[model samples]
Target: MGKLLIQGGIPLEGRVPISGAKNSTLPVMAACFLAQGETILENIPEITDVDVVMEICREMGGEGEWLERGVIRLHVPDTISCKTSYTLAKKLRASNLLLGALLGRFGWAEVALPGGDNIGTRPMDLHIKGLSVLGAELKIEHGYIRGGVAGGKRLKGGKIYLDFPSVGATENIMMAAAMAQGQTIIENCAKEPEIVDLANFLNAMGARIRGAGTDVIRVDGVSELRGTRYTVIPDRIEAGTYMIAAAATHGRVIVENVIPTHLHAITSKLREIGVRVEEGDDQIFVDGAGLFRPVDVKTLPYPGFPTDMQSPLMALLSTVKGISMIVENVYENRLRVVDELQRMGAQIKIEGRTAVIDGVARLSSAQVKASDLRAGAALIIAGLMADGETEVSCLHHVLRGYAHLEEKLTGLGARVRRIS
Candidate 1:
């Protein structure tokens, strides 16, 4: 196992480029199944989830390779087997998305339930409801989600109203509706930029989609899709992470290659905490003085403070002034990192879905473990701000999302070393 030993008190400076959006890449990879020929993708993040998704594609008879530093070539051919093995699907929660793509392509999909972070109970009921409305028969037998088209091998068009603006359900329904026989409308769809990016990429390949970055989405069924080369949108969450890290460490970091508008929620929060934030064309500058004010945060869907960033922001709030209260509205069990942060002498209390954090002057070094991906990143940032050396174990979780994280931190003047 690889672990990161972070030596604290370095102000991270220099320019760092953001990687591709993980949320967009997953659906775009699934979009390969709809292509009649090969699809080439650019700026792919070198995360473990990428490899897992590639394995899923390979199992379904797709070939892929890294064409460049951040480019991938995927060929699904004319036909693909529509089975997602239990072992494969359990690697990540996004694996459930293959069901919609496979069902649209082959009229059947027998996949296992997805597994990822234990933040909360992410239900597939919305996904099933949206697909079932398009004439799919879904059932959970043993541990596998067995589903297929009922009447024919074609998907019938229908309107799907989601109970929540779930990212997964929105992507799943989009994939299923892309190749349907008629028209499909999805109401209250997720309005995240990643979802919109996926829709744009699919539309480039002859899929008809409209109103992506809005609550309402409309799709017209297409007869077939052709190969297309596409570049993924920059990761807002990763950009937000770096911005928070800069704030927590009293560092001045100019993060580049990001959509400044996408970071409105994070940027606003940082400004509220007395951090000097400046935004330019696709870049954001954060200057910190190590002094912070505790603020209230309630995690919500897009345009609201994201739940993925809750842990990292909490780490930043730990060393600030006053008490900070964070209510996790998106995930019930997202406070998995609360215990680990406390190991470093953080004053945080968990009361049900709310986390009450009392500010401390500084954190002392401790050997802590990463509970999940985002939590792992939060701990790394905490370690960077701690008073002494902090060793973070179970680092594989961190690698599932961030690409070359230590290298990026090292570039920003952080004294972090990875060891076996």
Candidate 2:
């Protein structure tokens, strides 16, 4: 593992370009397997998760090569192994996505149970239920999800209603239904920008899908999908993290290469907290010199405050004038960062799903460990605003999502470096 040493009290000022959405890239890469020929994906983030996905793809007989710094070309074969080893599948949670693509293409898949950040109980019940509804027989055997169509028949599309708007389940069902026999309708689907990107990528590859950024999505089963070039959307979560970092340090930063409309919830919440946000065509300029105020935030589905941004925003709220209440409705253990932040002198209380934070004037540096990806990001923001040096361990979690995090922070005038 690596650690980051950050000297605090620097007002970050510069332009920070956001990378491609990691959430979008993973599902899109998995969807590429459903198509024949070559698929060129642009603006792919250089993260550890993506590398692991590429490795999994290669293991399944797909050839993936980096065309450029942020571009990848994947060539899918007509036939591929439907089984993924436990060692590869346990690398990241997105490994579950392969089940959908493999089941769609070959009508059978044997994938090991996925593993990811120890945030909470992220079950695969929705994924299994959705695929089972589409005429695929699914069962768990020896910690592997074994699924296939009975009688060697093709999947027949059907209606699927998710108990919750699970992003992984939505993406998995959509990909599996793309090659099914008939029409598939998904209700209460995830409407995040990443879902829309995946839908667009599938459409570009000749899959008939509609209502992507809405509550209901319809997919018309096609005979086969052909490869095409597609560009991914900007990482809104990463952009929101940088914006929160700027505000926490009383800095000015321009986060570029983003979809301004996709970040309405984050921008509006920051504005309500007394941060000046200037929106442009594809960028947002955040000025944090104004007076900061406490604001209540609730993490919900898209179009609401994202659960992914909850931690970083909490770090900013720690420096505000009064108390701020955060309700994390998506993940149960997202408040794991609260303990790390409290070590730096921030007063926070956790009661079930809500966290009541009483802002302090300033925080003192302390050594902390990141328990998850977003928690690691929150610690970075806290370190940038602290009095002295702060050391953050568990760098692998941060690297799994953010691309060149230390370099980006250093470019924005924050004193950050990685130590092995």
Candidate 3:
């Protein structure tokens, strides 16, 4: 096991380039199964989650290799296996996406139940419902989600209305519907930028898809899909984390290679908390040398404040002047990180799905363990704002999402080191 030893009190400054979206890369790599030729992907993040997804893709008979730094060459075969490794599939949540891609391609898929950060109940019911509506037969047997189209035939497109705007479900339905027999319309679907990126990728390969940035989406099925090269969007969640970190430590940071519009939700929240944010064509500048005000945050789907950022934002809010509250409408147990933050002298309380925080004048360093990916990042932010030293353990979770996190923070003048 490894841990991050951090000495607090340094203001982070300089440019930290945002990596490609891990959420976007996984589904796009899974979508490669729908095509039958070479697909080149650029700006892929060097994260453990990407490694897991690529391994799963290889297990399904697709050949993938790194062409250069942040570039990958994937050759999807005409015929691929429908069964995925249970051991590998359980390692990450994106493995569940393989069911839709494999089912769309081979008309059958036997994938294991997925596992990732234990933040909340992320079931595959919506995925199965959408796929089933698109003419798939899904069933959970043993530990795998088994079944596909009846008689091994092509999936027929049908309208699917999601009860909630689940991002994974929306992407699964979109991928399966892309190769269906007819037109498919999805109502109340997730409108995240990653969803639009996936739609753009699929459309680039001849699938007719529209209304991606809205709650409604339309997909006209194509008989065959050819591979195409694509680039992924930058990680907005990572950018938000850095922005919040700068505020917590009263630093100036330029988060580069990001789409400013994609971060409107985060930027607005930071501004509300008295942080100065400037937007350029593709970069966001965050200056945090002023007093912060306590604000209420509610995590909503897409266009709203993201649930992934709630933990880190809460860490920053802990140093504000007054009381702040964060309503986690997306995940149930996300506030579980409050215990670790409390170890660092943060005054936080959980009332149901809401976290009531009383901002402290300062925080003292403590030894803490990262419970999940985003929570791990929240600890690092807290460590940077605290006095003395803080050691954050269980770095595997943080590595699953952020790429070269220590190096990035170090470049920004934060005193952090990885120790075994």
Best-matching candidate per lDDT:
2
Pairwise lDDT winner, candidates 1 and 2? 2
**How high is each candidate's TM-score?**
0.98, 0.99, 0.99
Q: lDDT per residue, candidate 1, 1-420, as tens digits?
A: 589999998888988999998888988998788888888899899888988988888887888778888889888876677777789788788898888887887788887899988778998999999999988999998787897899767898999999899999999889888998899999999999999998999899999999999999999989888889999999899999999999888999999989999999999999988999999998999999745788999999999999999999999999887988999999988899999999999999999999999999998889999988899999999998999999999998889899989889999999999999
Poorly placed runs, candidate 3 (over 4 Å): none
lDDT of each: 0.90, 0.93, 0.93
Candidate 2 C-alpha lDDT tens digits along 56-77: 8898888988888899999879
Please give the ranking of all candidate structures by lDDT, highest first, separated by commas.
2, 3, 1
Model 2 stretches with alpha carbons more than 4 Å out: none
TM-score of 2: 0.99
Candidate 3 lDDT, 1-420, residue by residue in tens? 689999998999999999999999999998988998889999999898888877877887888888887988787797778888999988789999888888888899999999989999999999999999989998999999999797789999898999999999999999999999999999999999999999999999889999998989999999988999899999999999999999889999999999999999999999999999999999999999987899999999989999999999999999898999999999898998999999999999899999999999999999999999999999999999999999999999999999989889999999999998
TM-score of 3: 0.99
